[model samples]
Target: MPYRISRLGLVEIRSLDLDRDLDYYLNVLGLQLTAREGKTAYLKGWDERHAYSFALTESDRAGMVRMAFRTVDPEDLDYYEKRLKDFGIKYDIIPEDYRRGRALRFTAPSGHTVELYNEMDYTGNVLPTVNPGPWPEGLRGIAPPRLDHTLVTAPEPGKAIEFFQTVLEFRLSEMLVAPDGTIIAAWLWQRPAPHDLAIVPGKPGGFHHAAFVVDSADALFRAADILAMHKARIDYGPGRHGITRGTTIYFFDPSGNRLETFGGYTAYQMDPDSRAIRWTQDQIGPAVFYYSQELNETFLSVYT
Candidate 1:
């Protein structure tokens, strides 16, 4: 049975120091701190049940490594778990840490850990506290409807991509491979909103970035202006990506985790049989009026 995932619920990451990184997400990036327990912190972009985003203990080894999503129903979760057992896939049931209400944890085929929560723990909707436009030059928040997707570093992109398709029922909206058919990068989508997850070549078990879908092009620029003031240097963006057809801006957090604010993504809700895609160096380069430099050393090293 194919798992019917409704939408991305929240991302749970292990941070070395909760206060230091959580400070950037709350005070700098403008995510509302909905709740906190010991070393764990739950954050919110907009109001929902509990928190849709959070960070837990583990600041010493900094990297985004976990994500959580909402299932269409409890039956879907059971269907997925049973299918994993039938196919010989192993998973775990992690209890709600201070933030997650009731969640089950497991590792994806690519070796990335993910959590599935049936509901958000809180009662009220936690919306963005910062008014994006009113802020000075560098400090701004990404005004998105909710959490978008995540980029993960996978040792075997093929295995990872396959797991999402075979196990999670994610469709491949776009794929890029080398001459030998080694999957370099993949963009998968569950609904019309661009990609729900991205696969990049890396050592298994770490996150690349988590993206937020902004409402408009104006929000993209406003986000950049605010980030610039806060000294959150731009990794790339304020332009269109050839794959998702979305205008995006990439930057790093105080902890060096990547984050993107995007708009104008082509909806894939219509065509179920979309073709695969590959991009050339020129396609993703500065010639398209986008800039790049030695400054992108970190992003390029992991992605390219």
Candidate 2:
């Protein structure tokens, strides 16, 4: 099948304390605020070309509202619509918004809202395309370059994995399976950086973390310093992950939503003959946190 989805485009998350969470996102994480309407604020990385890749909305609770993926072309949306119809999946057509075009929205088998779109209003990057420096000046905090993948929780991850693989055409990159062949966790991707989405066993519709991309291992450590300076809740380490081999540090926003700054993962090409790397449940600790070789109780239990 032709690759329909191009890459992860945007994620909208709810915040219990918008002002407090927004402060952390702006000063500590260094996301550029693009626009605001009512209780919602839209933001993007300094290097993102789209109008916004992250949206924070005021709410009484914290969790993800939806995640969107950009399609390869406008026609791909129509193609997927047909496939969805054939599969008896229900969806809605969302009209154009401030900086985004029409979107097709649906709830995944995991109960997470998902959107697919082909057009977004281009606002350009922080630097000029003609003659740009390595980075923009006045950069604060960690200042990651772009948004990375997201991890969510599902009661039946195997079914969710099947939906993404068979319906959305995402390739499984890696997975953690029980001894009896049940899926504990699975990583699926359309783009090159290991996983665009990952699913773990938890409450349906649970939000784990949305990761941002830093440049290197040094940058990952720098992120730790910045998080400490801002007094953000550091959930886990400036450590390595055996799954993607990425350097990472997990932290929480003021609203208690988990976030991560990650780097150094090997790019995954969609090779037809390639099979997903597997990790048995006995090795779950190393599969998730390479440095500790153990799972923290909070890491698996806590989610927005």
Candidate 3:
């Protein structure tokens, strides 16, 4: 098998006020505005090579609209489509030039809308492919290099994990389980990073947070400063996650959707039968936050 799923392509997010959120994404979060249509504004990280890596759509609610995974092979789309059909998983095969190139949209077992695509317009990063400098001129705000990962709330994380394991071929990097053998949370990786997606137990269809990748722990600290300068509510840390060992800071946009700035993690490529780091429920404090040894009530209860 090839690299079936390479990376997450785009995150379509809902905003109560698209203009406000769009400004926050571009000015504070440092994404380039790729396009705009109606109430939706498309954006991309500086290092991404796609027409758009993010979409902010105006809606009454603040949450995820859809998240797409870019596949390594076009045939993987057809292969997964057939797998979905045979498994009785309803899906819609969207043709090219429509949304984000050719894609298949399906509701996962956890009720989150997910898309898989193998094609995208090659919009080069800020630097040229050959003999380019490290960064662009006058980068704005936090200026994270790329979108890293997303953590969503899944009421039945085990089922979602199982589907990702057997069907999508994702490997579990870490999981926190109850004594009854229930998955409280799971981190799943495809390739090139520790986790492309994380599932925490919550109501079906809920969204938790989407994270962006910076260059270093210093960048995360600078991000915290930028958040404070912008008067954005700092939800948590200028600290680290024990799970991924990434320096992170969580904050809220104007619309109250949580976002994170992160870096300083050792990326892992997981093999079949690779040992997963398991944390029992009692030690979940250290599992999530190493220094605090505690979790805020909102960390467990808040979702959109």
Ranking by TM-score: 2, 3, 1
- Model 2 agreement with the true structure over 127-183: per-residue lDDT tens digits: 999979988999888888899889999999999999999888899889999999887
- TM-scores of all predicted structures: 0.82, 0.97, 0.95
Off by over 4 Å in 2: 265-273
Estimate candidate 1's RMSD in Å: 4.7
lDDT of each: 0.66, 0.88, 0.83
Cα error, residue 59 of model 3, in Å, equals 0.5
Worst 10 residues of 2 by lDDT: 264-273
List, residue by residue over 1-304, the lDDT tens digit for candidate 1. Answer: 3337767776766665677777677665677667687766767665344555545454566676577777777777777777778878777876566644566678886776787666555455532445543323432265454577888888787888888878777887777666666667788876555578888778777677777766576777888887887788678877666567666778877656678776644333425566566654434443222334223456646421
Better of 2 and 3 by TM-score: 2
The segments of candidate 1 whose C-alpha lies over 4 angstroms from its true place after superposition are 1-3, 47-50, 56-58, 99-102, 122-140, 264-275, 278-296, 302-304
Alpha carbon lDDT at 266, candidate 3: 38
Residue 191 lDDT in model 1? Answer: 57
Candidate number of the best lDDT? 2
Ranking of predictions according to lDDT: 2, 3, 1
Please state the error at residue 160 of candidate 2 in Å.
0.8
